[model samples]
Target: MSAEEVHNRISMLRAERGVSRKDLAAALGVHYQTIGYLERGEYSPSLFLALRIAEYFGVPVEVVFSLRPFPRLGSEVVK
Candidate 1:
């Protein structure tokens, strides 16, 4: 069996938005370390938290999390 993995773009999104980990953590009602863990792929957010994060960032939930690694933004997809 493959090891469980949850891929997210929290760090990239946060960087693009210029949002601090502490600030997002406070807004999400979680410890700042939780944000770090999520960013580092050491933890995955709950459904509620995932929705909250998407809403907070003003993006679709699909923009934040995915079952597969996403192509780089603005990069063309290979055929």
Candidate 2:
């Protein structure tokens, strides 16, 4: 079976938290470059790693990773 592309908000979350890729990588026990690869959508993380990332950010896993593309902020229309 083919693997699907996993979408994530790592970069946006990092920026919002003022966390650096290196710091996040270290916290996740992964190479710093891996964080960059994830942010750029060049690599898909394992479920374990995904959970760890969410834990690091103190959010639910769905908040960090999604099967569908997340909508951009301010893209929603109010009724």
Best model number under lDDT: 2
Q: What TM-score, to 2 decimals, does candidate 2 have?
A: 0.92
RMSD in Å for model 2: 2.2
Runs in model 1 deviating more than 4 A are 1-3, 77-79
How many clashes in candidate 1? 0
RMSD of 1: 2.1
Candidate 1 lands at a TM-score of: 0.86
User: Lowest-scoring 10 consecutive residues by lDDT in candidate 2?
Assistant: 70-79
Every model's TM-score: 0.86, 0.92
Write one digit per residue (lDDT tens) for candidate 1, span 1-79. Answer: 1356778889899999999999999999999999999988888788999999999999999999887887887778553
Q: Taking the tens digit of each residue's C-alpha lDDT, what string does model 2 give over 1-79?
A: 2268899999999999999999999999999999999999999999999999999999999999988889988778641
Q: Rate residue 60 of model 2 by lDDT.
A: 99
lDDT of 1: 0.89
User: What do the candidate models score in CA lDDT, each in turn?
Assistant: 0.89, 0.94
